[model samples]
Target chain A: MASKLGIIAGGGEFPGLVIAACRADGRPFHVLGLTGHADPKIIGDAPADWIRLGEAGTGFKLLKEAGVAEIVMIGPVRRPTLKELAPDWRTTKFFARVGLKALGDDGLLRAVAKEIESEGFTVVGIDSVLADCLAVAGPYGGLVPDDQAQSDILRAWEVAKGIGALDVGQAVVVQQGIVLGVEAVEGTDSLIRRCAELKREGPGGVLVKVRKPGQDRRLDLPTIGLATLREAAAAGLRGIVVQAGGALVLGREAIGAEADRLGLFVLGREDAC
Target chain B: MASKLGIIAGGGEFPGLVIAACRADGRPFHVLGLTGHADPKIIGDAPADWIRLGEAGTGFKLLKEAGVAEIVMIGPVRRPTLKELAPDWRTTKFFARVGLKALGDDGLLRAVAKEIESEGFTVVGIDSVLADCLAVAGPYGGLVPDDQAQSDILRAWEVAKGIGALDVGQAVVVQQGIVLGVEAVEGTDSLIRRCAELKREGPGGVLVKVRKPGQDRRLDLPTIGLATLREAAAAGLRGIVVQAGGALVLGREAIGAEADRLGLFVLGREDAC
Candidate 1:
């Protein structure tokens, strides 16, 4: 029998997807939902504990008492300030140990994962939990990218990688050889929405997402869902390109259908650097 | 006496500043203002020829007829589409010659400068004509950066240079070691304004601007003026940092006074990479 799982849920649909997957597999689990981040509706009727983001001690105690042996942290959480975070004793200790403020988002995640492991929980990656959710090589739907989009894909790939190497961002928008924007702390969705207004009067732009160089696979990998496709289409983007096997695609079928309906191509390339 | 200068004016106060400099020095010059870009008010009563941006052949002809022996291109023009440009026969020939669409903004500017030189006119950098406009090392006003602001400046400098190497952008906003935004096609002012919404709860961000690696100095170098200072202040940024001797600082005294009044530092760093 699969060990009881602990889900450390942040904002977005990924946590709900994981919960459904567990239910289908008959794997027992408990959720520790982050307040102000995770959707309370998603946790309805589930075995769960709710706590503020800075309440590390409470979260760990709740998971342990619930008899969880395995843990999976999922979804997006904007970086909060120290004032906003209001770290408790355990979180303060964790920050002291990790030098939290000096690290980027990925760095922070790696540290959190390490601390979770140190507490006797076997931390697992989302890819390992939901292997089917990983993006595959080539178009997700029936649409294929044309030469202009391919060129943009290649251009954005290099730029995204360049920024990623600096631990800056994982996504970029390019149109007709011009970079419309690069993702930073505001996240990919905001980046897309911002780039929409800056779009040139030519062929629409392409959104490219990739894993940061040397980034921990278990934490904060580039993720896109149906919402991403809809936003891209609404933002006048022609297509989406993500690194195959390096990013996540939640609700693939729905996303594929949505992409087709919006006339936006969703391609997964294996050539991301 | 200075050679009769040919000013290829785009949009912004840089053209006006250049024109003011010319009048102050009693230098004979003619302005070739781009129709959709330059301010008609700035070009008022000046020996100027108003033409569309795509009328390169006519521009050259007018300059030659006005006895222009030296040329300077200044100001920021949003990248326009070929359709929006409505390229005349000369621009079409120039694009065919230079592979225009394949180049970034700086690359296109270099090609234009080279073409102007080939047309028998000397292309001068803004630095050469307006030497006083060049940014000097250290603070521009009474305010000095705090340690945290200093750290943010260093972080944004590396990022700005990293993006610059990709020919992507010249500016980035960093707050508490997190990058808020990076400038792309939307320009520095837009980048600052966008980052304002993304500003974290702690100390404000710092705007770092640098010259692109291997970039031709004769073309677009990073430039900041009174408006830049106002926008950065309004965006809740702690300060602005520019590459010492590598960027233009227009209206220095007014900017310095404004910086002091707004409680923002405008530092020029000498060690930008």
Candidate 2:
């Protein structure tokens, strides 16, 4: 009998990838994909269950009923907006227990994970099954970082790490030892746009993204892809530095090609400095 | 003979207040206020020379030739867009020599100040002249922060100070120990508004603004006013914590009244934190 795996899909192609990787490993997988966040294509290709983002109680019940003893959470959920995701009685009770007045993305997610784990299922890191997707060290494509761009990358990397240490966020935009922006809950894409606005007439700066120190790799992994490359080019960014083996390279080949075309250096550095 | 002081005014009522304080002290004061940023009302009330923001080179020459040995940079200058500031030959030469790819607000101001000081004038802290305008420690109005809000304030304060240490602005918007945003060149009002967007439908969080660690208060002292109070209320913020003696309070009576009405806690903690 094959081992059955439970996957909590958020948004994006990550869910589909996780399913494919599990099947390739000959493991039977059950998925709980989020509505409006998970790719519809994932539903057709992967054998899985589904739930809306706010239906946490239903998700828990379904996972438990399926005899899911271990689970993995993956993909990006649409961020909880003020109108959407009014907590159900179970969730409200759970929140009451945590007692935080203003819960942010991390806080909310951690709370939900705790509630799910309380039901007896062990939550596992998504990377444990998809480790092959981790980015390698050094430049990804034909483009190489010049010494000047490399210096900016190192400086940005240091600042990004500091931000992570503070548990603020994992990314920072820097040029000439000055921070253009730091990623908070707003995420990297918006940060890139803001950096573009600040450096409107220049070649832009280096964007360094890394996993927070001691971050749970199962969730909150830094991710970059072709869309990221396109956005960086749009923002006039000269390059990007992501932590090697610490981030997911979604659409790695396409992103590399795009970076090469845009003359943007997309390098993965192993040292999480 | 009284010491004749030169005031380089920016925008806001700060210049007007400084002028009034100088007159009350019977000090000889002159102003070189920026056009498009400085209030025209300031020109009538303040006895000072006025000039456009980008015409700093000429302004410095005039102040130096007037035998002004000490200068105070005051008021809020509308941050100049790169296109708006048409740099003259001297400004271009200075930028070329500095080899800085991006000049943020602080960097630009520091460079201009360096040029002025090289010509023999000392840049004085605005606080040195208007000590009475400094905020006092403890709650100002009827609204004392609850324990939860106080914890949030302490958390936001530490993060704000860290941001200051980086010389990347001096304000942070935080909620439940999570930083919603860090002020860069965007300034505090916008920073508060951005945090509002991320708020999870609660009383909102605290806005913490402080003098940058080791900052030369001669330029860019943190400031709040009636407008700041209105912005905070609009952004759903519960309170504001500013570094006492390290920040300027404008429209104090009106601001206190509004804070009282809005149930917003406005406190100026001592700079020791």
Candidate 3:
């Protein structure tokens, strides 16, 4: 029998989808829901334990005690300050060991995964479990981007790459040759919502998301889902583009349907930065 | 006698400050206020004529008829779509002649200045008109940045330069090694205000503004005024840092006094990116 899967769930519908995937495949799994992040409804009936971010000791112990053999950390978690983190003894020791090496999002995540591996647990990525969720190349939902949107997409791609190389952000919004906004720690949803208020009167902006340069593919690849689609539509955005095979597309069918209904294009481009 | 100055005013108090400088120095001037931007109070009772942004032909004619010789363009103007700009015949011809070369802010500004220069007018920098407004090196208001704040300032400087080189923006906000936000077409005030909402729970961020790489210094040098100070204070930012001698600091004495009163450090750093 395959080893039981351990899911370290964070915010958004992503965690719930992963749990549903496990059930559908008859794969036994356990969840470690991060407090203040994972939805209560999603963790409701699952065999799970809840812990604060600083409670790394409790988290790892719970997973081991629950007979979890393989682990996958999923979803978005707001970056907390050192004070807010309030790291426990084990967590403090972990940071002390890593030192400044764990600075950017990818660095910190890789360090944590290494620690988990050192604790005798195997680590996996969400893509391995839900291969269909990886965005494919081409227009999604049978809608193609217009020439104007294509131009904006290309501009935003260059910007996203620039910021990503600096480890500043992974997404940008551009409209009619003007950059509407750039994502930072505020995340993509907030980025889109704010850019909506700053949109120009002409064609709406396009949101382009790509993976950060030198990023660890296993952790925190760019993601778009139903919630992101709704935000973009409400923000009067013309379209959404994610790096093909470099980002995740959650609830793909539903997202495509919503995009078509809203007269917006959802594309996964391979020619991306 | 000095040539009558042609003040092409946009939004913000910078324009009003220029008019005041001209008045104090006994230099005759005519103001051509862009309708939607210039404050009504500032343009009131001055030798001024108001016109929409697209009326370039009318604006130039008014300046020429006013016996103006030198021109200075000051203040922030939101980037408008071509439709919103509603370019007149001359403006259309100007864009056509410049073509793709006038895409970025600096590029567009240079093209416009060249056009004005060709029309028997000399273009001058705001520093030429208001020399004291240039930011100087050193800690302003007697407040010094703590080590942590200094680190964030340095980080934001690099990000600012990264975006600037791309001709994307000139300002960025950073806290605890995380980039809070980056300015784009929405401008710095909005960038600071929005980042305030996304500020981390611990130390507030620092706003860093620098000259864009290869920017035309005579046009749109990064600027901070009393309005910017209040916005930063309201946003709970620890300090504001601009490239020393590379940016404009309007109302310098008042800004120092306000920064002192608010217990925020306003420094002009020479070791900038």
Candidate 4:
């Protein structure tokens, strides 16, 4: 008997990518879409169910009934507001136990993961299932960053670490050592857009994204994709740097080709410090 | 001869406020407008000179010639780009000595301050001249921050510290635990405006402005004014917090009156950590 893999899908193309991977390998799966966030088309005709974002117990019961033992949660989900979600009694009870520690997003995710584990489903990082999607740890594309960009990348690397230490964000945009934008709850795409507006014509501009120090990688890893490359080029950025082996760069070949077309850089910086 | 106080003024109302203070007390002064940043009209009849931003030599020469030994640098100056300023021989030579550290605004300011001190000029904090302009510590409104707003403030305080630790910026806007805006090159008013758009109807939005830790007090101090109060009210925020004794709240009476009228809180949280 085949053990079915379960997928908890959110927004963005990640769920689509994961589904493609699952199907290519002939893995049977159950998809649970978080209502209002997940794309219906991505779930397709797969054995699937829909659950409101805060309906923990309902989601758990459905997955259990479907005979799923392991799951991968993927894609972007804006942190839902309690009022907006109107959490059911089960989620409310779960949060009550979480209490004040659930104030931070990381804490809330950890607590949620722990709850699901206690109920007997294992939470595995989606990356383990799709290691090929991990960002390449070197210069990507035809364009190599110039000396000025290297300097900017180092400065941004230091600044990003400071940002990550607080767990407020994962990315900082810099040009000639001036920070154009810092990501927060608004997310990275918005951060890149804001940087495009704030940027002055300059010699050195780079996007630096890093994993939060002490962050649990199994839950969330800093990620970039084709959209990030397009936006960086639009923002007149010279390069993009991610902590090597710590971020996902989906469709890496396409992203590299795009970067080359735009005369931009996609570098997975191991250590600029 | 009364020791003449020199004002190195930038944009915004802070310079105007300081000018009024000097005039009210009959304090002899010389004002130097950083070209393109300061409003020429703001100096109105005050003995003032205009110098290109980053023309440090010209600025120092003028102040020395005017027999000014003490100076206060005030208001917001868009950190000048090298090509835009076309630095004079002195600033060019200075940057050469400072090397790559000249890359950041804080490093540049610190370097400039050291140079000024080396030339025998004492840089004084503007608050020393007008204590009333310093933000009042504690409550100042018709409405107090409820529990949720308080939680947001603490979260924002932590985030702002991280931003400041990198010498990036000094303000952050938050709602619940979500950071709506982080101030960087765009400045505070722009940050507030951005937040107004990002805000969803909520119980917890607040502005937390703080002095960067280990930042030089003689230079930029975190500031807010009646404009901030009106904008925050427009954004549907519940409260505001600035580190006690560390921020400027221009026209205190008017700010308090406006906050009361808008039913918003202007709290000066000393240390809620």
| Candidate 4: regions farther than 4 A off | A100-103, A271-273
* lDDT at B236, model 4: 81
Off by over 4 Å in 2: A23-26, A34-47, A50-61, A77-122, A146-148, A175-177, B23-26, B34-57, B76-118
TM-score of 1: 0.97
The CAPRI-style docking tier of model 4 reads medium
Alpha carbon lDDT of each predicted model: 0.88, 0.77, 0.87, 0.82
Fnat value of model 2: 0.21
TM-score of each: 0.97, 0.84, 0.96, 0.96
lDDT of candidate 4 over B107-207, digit per residue (tens):
77777778888999898888888878777678866667887887888889998987888888999998877788889998888888888877765564899
User: What would the per-residue lDDT of candidate 1 be over residues B7-33, giving only the tens digit for each residue?
Assistant: 989888899888888999999999999
**Least well predicted 10-residue stretch by lDDT in candidate 2 chain A:** A99-108
Predicted structure with the largest DockQ when compared to the true one: 1
Residue-pair clashes per candidate: 0, 4, 0, 0
| Over 4 Å off, model 1 | A103-105, B103-105
Say which candidate scores most in lDDT: 1
Q: What is the DockQ of candidate 1?
A: 0.73
lDDT (0-100) at residue B75 of candidate 1?
84
Model 4, residue A272: distance off in Å is: 6.9
Kindly list the per-residue Cα lDDT of model 1 for residues A89-169, writing each as its tens digit. Answer: 999999998886645456888889999999999999998778788889988888988988888888899999999998899
lDDT agreement of model 2 with the native: 0.77
Q: Show the lowest summed lDDT stretch of 10 residues, model 4 chain A.
A: A100-109
Which digits, one per residue and each the tens of the lDDT, describe model 3 over residues B6-57?
A: 9999888888889888899999999999988888797778899988888889
TM-score of chain A, predicted model 1, versus the true chain A, to 2 decimals: 0.97
